[model samples]
Target: MAKAPGFVSLKEILTTFKISRRTAFNWLKTINQQLQAQKLDQVVNIPRYGYKLTDRTKKSLTQKIAKVSSPQMGHETILNAHERQTEIILLLLDQEHYLSINQLAKMFHCSRNTIIKDFKALKRHFPALKIGSSRLGHRIISDENSIRLTVYELLLRQDKLVYAFINRLNYSFSQAKELVIKAQQQLHMSFSENSLQQLTYLLLFTKWRITHNQTIDRSENWQWIAQNTKDVLPTCTKLLGKLGGNKELKGEIVFLSKIFLCSQATEVDCINKNLYHDINNIAQEIIFRYEQLTEQQISYRVFTKTLCNHLYATFFRVKFGIPFSSSEVDEIKWQYPVLIKFTAIACAPLEHYLQKKLPSEEVALICLYFGSVNNREYREFTESDKLKRALLAEVLVVCSSGIGTSAMLYHELSKTYPLIKFSLPLEIRDLAKIFQHNYQAKLIISTTILPKGKYPIPAVKVKAVLTKHDQTIIDSFLRQEVPRKLEHNASAVNSLVSIINEYADVKDEKGLRLSLDKFIFPGLQKNNKADLPTLSNLLPAKHIKVLRKKDQLKWQTVLKWGCNLLEQDEIIDQFYFEKIVQLINRYGPYMLIANNIFLAHAAPSNSNKKVGLSLILLDQPLEICSRGESAWVTCMFVLSPGKEKEHEKALEQLVDIVRNQENINRLLKAKSPQEVRQFLLSFY
Candidate 1:
């Protein structure tokens, strides 16, 4: 058959030149320009075909190609040293057998001296390989493992060379790829892009080694493998069977099982008995500590199960020295210091089991788990709900059933009537007493009917299951009563301003009254409170403890002791200690506001109903992770506050103390809680 006219598709040009569509079009335009300059026919595009060059245009292009190939223009075509070395490495790696100097010179179209120099360069780059002249040829000799690793590195450095490496294996990757896809489907999990690439390379490497009659020495911890990898053994067996199973396949299976175990699997069931027990115990302790610190109950079963699976994979990676990376460690530390700190403490047992300290990246991973758990629990209360809650007026809820119906009503009312703050459920009989006690209570919602004229507060009766009508009634009541409550607050503030003006000379009485009005009626305030509450007011003598005798204490012990003081004083719930430690673990010792002062805290929760401060002055300085600062921490200030608004004043006051080095010095010198309180009072 006669050859078809020389033609090239736009897609083919793009793939060949590695250029974009526009560039390809521009090249064709340039070619047409050159042909026009020569006063010959231009390249023509045929519909449903590609660009076709006329016989005359082809002859002109051939002459142009010859001109560009001249010695003066040939510098542009020459490969750089790095590029040449990469090509040589690929050539060596892809070859079925070693190549002689004369053969490489022929392939590279270079001199014998040039080929020898390239070989010398390759030998330097890959010291593990023995590159020297042999009886047969100049060859690269290395163990299968070393050669595979070098090839993998080359592929990583040049991703475009992946297909080249695969082709050189003389083994199709389709079967291995199918095996992975099937395993992922069967296991109910998916591998990450990086993981899939690693697996593909591994399969190809394994096949090459097996075909070459090369075997890897057993280096995995067999005991650990026997106990924990039983679940993945079947999958590994199937994979090896397809790869043409051999006598040394068990070592490869063990290796493959480890890789599968370290994957981000949804669940991990088979674990070493001792490791499982240790992980469970550690998880329980961590949850317990977290609960005590936050004073919030976490779903134990769900948290433990998720944590156990994650730790199992972590344990495997740590044991086998498998590298792991996380870009979110710093972000997690900054955002969830308390949770990460708690996670770190929880991870202590695992560290002991691994016989090494856990890296910050691993600790950050654990923090992510806790952060997820916390997010799931509080997913309902969004940012808008928080804003609306601040504007809501307090209302008493009366239910004869106590918590059950009242709690439901509270959540429902919170969503429906965003302007109402429903109090905890109270008995119908306690309505009169509640009315007398709660001056802010604007209206009362009741599940049961109440007697008329029984209390001064307005009452609305509704069914346990609120209907649209009930919502309308409650919404209507809030619309009328909320504004009236604001007016009442303004009037009270006006009265207080009048009293204050009588006692002092006031030039700006109007301005003073406006300020007082804004302060009294929080809704009227333009700016949130900027000043921190006085440290003396927040930290009482009862919550402070002074350690007079010198005693060595672990950083964990210091956190627990401070937390114990806060818990004893009813400043925080039990888990607050773990939260404090978690914060330290996540963010390091950045909380050390001064030379000796350590300010420990967590996010506000119900456990901290009121702002509480505990001061623990150690007799001797203790070591802590300071992110490269001095680790001698002598004074620990544990602050547990119920809400951000409630503690804003206290934190401001604390910051002032922290900023002043003189105050910190005085605080360190204080021998007793009374002394510390006295010194803090001096600032107020």
Candidate 2:
């Protein structure tokens, strides 16, 4: 109280004077009364905080605050920019109220302009270091957790004054080191040299925060804070209690337990029984999303199980904060930038579920898990799988019957020909629109005879009324119209070879010819580079639109706009758009795959001639309400997986492009469609 009259915690006051709370409060009351009688500013009590002294009050009480604040290096050592910025951060953490520019300049032996520059430069690294004029002068309001993490980081780099910071406040610096080392040895065979020191400092720093009335919000992550720390909670409880902590409060202990979760050795196989199940569920989803994005299935045994345990361990480490150093991270980032980006997208739901952002090292670590297993090691499709692909065969169910009958017929035929895509029954007059748009449809089963010159697509006349003869006719028509070959001419393959030769020197013309024939020829190799559609192939400049808030578009409106782009290219029929709407209405906004990015699609429709992908970037978000969930959508991607799931490659590329908020911002800020297209081209 005599040397430094900044805000000090009640615990520190009581501990220093060896007094109870009541005694401390009574002393504060008396001190305030005496100061008020003298017409001087008294110590102010801030709820959730202990006490702070105003400069006028300190000046009035000439006996108090005898010494001015000094730097860690005293008057001898002048700090460089980086060192001074870090020192400034440390100094702010000491003051309860604002420290003026003049005071700071005096303490650091610098000019006001130098301090201002330091403020600006420090903010570049520590964005949370808020600098603003308040009651009297410019003071920083830095987050406690962030500042402590900064301290931990400083300690990591062997900052000498880090310990002085803890000691200056007369805070407890317990030997939690011996305890942590003992517990870690019980679980791990060998540990890193500084692991004990890091864990010890983390626990003590947390205890220091608790003592100073700066505690973690217990109610924030109550679910994880409650159940996920059972194994380590008791140990942490004993350790904290031994170091003069409030034994009744378990919040600090719970936080320490989470730290313990992230500290296991690489060779350890310990599965945190409580956290593993949740982590496993997240792992399953990431794998599924990864498969969908890449359009290739990953086996569950090695990849799935490994990712689950790895994520379980890494989750807490990332959440709590760990700086990882890996040379491979840089190389992997440079070499497979797209893969890392896609992996992050796939891991997005996990991050959302946990409500925490993962660091790049964690993301890169997951990429290594994907890289180990993702060399086109796709699951071999069985005969049944091939049949399922053929099942995209569409049939136009034409009926002159009313709406009620059409509804009944649609479901009945759907169940009857489970493999076929039976379009909802349309009136005979509706046949023209269907024929014009859905020319890829193989057959039209009509309740009444169509006009002779009405359409080029073949039709079968079936009775509107139920009959055994009608079923036979429908059965005979679909069996013959089972999905036909891809139908590529010799010239198509020759042109492809010539294009490849033109751009790249063909070292193996004969080998390249064989590969091209297989890629082009039906059923030979659907996954070939030539066959798998990508964003570059599907979404041209014409297909992308920059929408705005002024348009006042709804979810369905932008959905239609995306569909219209594909429809213009004849990649999909109008019915495909209708199908997406119907399915979304029936199910939910499953189309909103990630935050603000809507991947609008439905099951493949064989009637669509080619795979289509289109984008609509809204300057403002559109709220999508459905039968289930509701979400705001920023970007809507319309994908028509025509006849096959070939659009997956395109979807994968789109995920890579927009998964990051930064990239989305960059794309949205583009002035023209050509700029947007060129931006996309850069990724490929």
Candidate 3:
């Protein structure tokens, strides 16, 4: 029949007061009516259990009980744990002297054990506040800033409680608001209404604390605040001085400056020249790095200005260890791994300047800035448009030697049939490899022999240079192979072109197409049906070569020997070997694809005659550096693809092998070239 801590069952109340069930029910109805009249929540009843009062309802009822209580009543009111805790905190803040646990127990009409438990619970919420018993008695110990933050948290939790406390201290809220307005006007900055309210409450609380002979310990970085926020510091100092002079004015100044810096307010010329320059430089660098990775341009002016404004607020949060909440960080990271990675790398300088490593959430916020800008360039395509592009036949143009001739043919063909997406020009020998990797290519137009039976896609032989007759043959072939339904709408394409021209400074149609293609489909465009080529097909036994190291050899010599093996096999011309050497010298051995394994090859050029692979296992390991990454080379593969770009598939397979430590270990441990080839072919 006893009442529970925060609730009392109707049965219990009836039994304890010796009342009838009907009377108890009627009393509950009256209480509900009164609560409703006061605009507070009524008690909720569980079907099988009892009536329960919410925390708000309990607090309201407790306040009403306290208001009507008198000493002549001869009975004390009971306070719940939350009410007791709030009372304890207010009491500690108001009094200069400490109150012992026994004294607090008598004051709350609770046992010392309950008071100790309340203090324990309160400590968890305010980590910065030290609550313990000393020779003097129990007291709350914390730095001024910690106390201020705790007060802010308390104010946020129960506004009525805070207002009551402030009212007791005779702090004028209206006067505080006036001081905040004066500060804003003097600093030439405007704060949001919410910010203004928060500042007013903070100033009022600070004045009350200082006047009660309780001064906060100075822990703020005044020097840093003065240097970085010189423009706003004077106004903040004046406002704090007006509230309460020099007792804790320095800490007050630091706190107010933080508010100004972090407020979601817009101000013209709020950022100083040096800080503006630094933020701008960092923003530009980030955008440039993003462009390099994506191969798409973004509007730098607007993005930089917006980023600078964000950083101004973020700088304060980072410097002062303020918590930043970003709920979408995980989702953004999952959706845009490449963007996040590049952004993190590009923001290294900002991180260093801030002297704090950015949390993933903060980095994800930065990604959003770039994403918003890029979204305007490449709006989400319609599902039908996506399907049309997906079904379009990818055509590869094979032209004779001469970059100029190949480029000219590519442009002409692309212009003639805008609907058909074409690959950059490839040589006839490279066609098979290019087709294997680019399974999306359903047709090939070659200027030389078709290399019959080498490709799965159909091939059309044309003159080294285009002619009117060749154009007719291409048009006839396209009619039969490419479905007419897959063609893009001319109007839609032109509209997209116009949109791009309006937003971007593209000089011509070719530039526009290239940019649009890159923006739409980043990385290499691939078909879902494109399967990775098997290792056996890419590295035949005849192509595998092993070398026995006689004494020691330089890393360059090791690379040269592998290239020579491919050249001697007639897989590539001498020019290919020279090109490979030139590549290594200029770019280093970045071609060392895996641990102790190097796959060296050059772009498909005139030097490459046919697709070829040569593997050389060094008896002695040679250390080589490639693209700033170093690897010990014990096994090397020299790939030469005829003008057909055969190396793409082989390179992809090699990367997979390198990624698998087990496969790389097995290959390195193989005794002979035949064993290495067998191990690689196991993947098939």
Candidate 4:
């Protein structure tokens, strides 16, 4: 029997392509499909991995080549040497070039004698050139472009590995086919289109990296240093023990190690240095903000909240050590809305620009707006005609639930009935003398049911019946619209101290026994204040320390006021300056100076000063201010030299005080600067 037409073995193909068994199998399958699609009936099989070219594949491939040469096909090929050599010689002459017989022999892989015979046949066809040999080299002296196209056409008939290269690089196969068509069109080259397809596919895979981002004819380096660096850094950090040993670490290390395979060591190091610098900058800023808020008794519990997206963005390059991608940037861009919203209610104020720039949807902005308005509920009061008449004689209402609740009531009444500022509680017995002592205050309210003649400050009972004829009751203090301030009514300072003392005197081992009893113990009270830091039940120790430091500073400042011999104005001025400095240091010099000195502010564009700043100021040196409206602010907070965060907070507070009409009025009324500073300071 005649041997079947032979073909290359799968093993040989795999070795030639340097591909794994599986990959080789896949390639063979693809080749077979291409063959069968064209209806060539030829079979080949490796009998392994269910992957082989079947009978139909080889016939299809061979027929595909034959179709190009078939007379019925649109294009024709000159297969005989004599006929092809005439065309080759004429094609070269058309471009003003001549190919020596020797050159033709080397190009076609034939003997010089065979090439000479081909040239003689070509001369008979074109009658143009002499067959000759030269020592320098059998050079091509004809049209380079035409000759090149001729050679290209001849090779195109053989196979299509070139076209396959283009497809593998992710270009559309149609696009790859178009490129081959253009090469053939421009050069009068013709080929079995199947051959070009095969060539482009191989080229696509091998050259994928280099050609990925390029769409034009330009070439680019497939290997990028930054890309390599990103792949390697995580492993380096993990190996150095900087990153933890969990799954996350393992994955990052693997990723980075792969990058090293693609990149040089120098590139990796450069990327690492940049990441370290950025991370350190962020960490240091966070630490400084933590310290500032701690000093202010603000909560820091929100600092640990980060979305999955933010974590990825921040650590991707710094920890994972990867080149940045647009996808990552986009994720972070959308994440800002959520991040800013959550941060609004956090204990520490966010960076000032965020507070100013973010809309009400942002948590910090919402929190600040809400914080500006008092929300405490208050009791409604009504007066009888008799009480109104007595009020003309100056009566006071007092509640002995301690000054806390009553003080709130006093403020409510005082705003509408400004005449009765001295409404002391019924506890003070010297009513007439107390009423006479204050020019601004006249009436008082008493919490306990007491007779009018018995108490100090011209007391009125809490339950005093109301009368319709008393217009002042309806028109003045009883008006419901005025809001009350926050009041702390739990345990009085004296009561708490006395209870603690009694417990200590009794040597109570059960802990705070008398204090708990007298105070009507709240839910889950700890025995020792010292235990506060250890209690995970409470907020972190960081929070408690912050609260303590703030309280300590306030009390210390008050104590200093009582002991100091300086003029009141001098004392207040010193305190105010201290506060100002603190704000500037905390927020940054530009923000502090702008907020405090320049008084720059802006409200919502849609509303008439509904919220936001009402004033703006420009920078000015102290020399100009020394002469002043000749008036220097008495209550200010100043940071120590070189302390930015403290200065920022101080500046913020100073601006807040000056902008607030009520606070400013209170400060101006002070008998001394110290009292002014103390009063202003207490408001925050």
User: Model 1 lDDT vs. the true structure?
Assistant: 0.61
lDDT of 3: 0.63
For model 2, how many clashes? 0
In candidate 4, stretches whose alpha carbon ends up further than 4 angstroms from where it belongs are 1-229, 232-271, 293-684
lDDT, candidate 1, 1-684, per-residue tens = 002356667777655544446545655675667678788787789876787777765665533321111121223233334455566666665566777777755554345666666677777866666665786676556765456555554543333344455656667777777887676665555554344555677678778777767765564565567765445666776887877866356776766676776755445555556666876776665565444344456656756766666676677777776545432245446654545555565454466567987777677766665555432322344444433332243787665422222344554555444434665545554555444443566788886567788777688987544666787787778778775532455577778877987899989988887777666554334324545455666788887888877668787777777778878867788877777677667646645544566777777866675677887888788888744544678788887765644565565556566547787777778988888888877766
**Candidate 4 deviates by what RMSD?**
36.9
lDDT of 3 at 443: 79
lDDT (Cα, tens digit) per residue for candidate 2, span 1-684? 434546678988765644346645655775677678888777777877768778777766655322223476453443445666777777776667877878877775445666777777767755544666775986655555455556665654445566556555554445667767666654442233334455676666676677788765442443564565443555666766876677666656655565566642323333356565777778887876676455556756645665665675577777655454332356556645766777877787678777887778678667756654532222233434423332333777675422222333454455455445655555565555555442456787775557776677788875433346667877777667772322234566788988998899999998888887766542333245456877888878998998755667778888898999989888888888888788678756655555788887766546476787888888887888886568788778887774556765776677766767888778777766677788988899
**What is the per-residue lDDT of model 4 for residues 578-605, given as tens digits with 9 covering 90 to 100?**
4433444344432222222222111112
Worst 10 residues of 4 by lDDT: 609-618
| TM-score for each model | 0.43, 0.45, 0.42, 0.20
The numbered model that scores best in TM-score is 2
Model 2 TM-score is: 0.45
Q: Count the backbone clashes (under 3 Å) in each candidate.
A: 12, 0, 8, 107
Model 3 poorest ten-residue lDDT run? 65-74
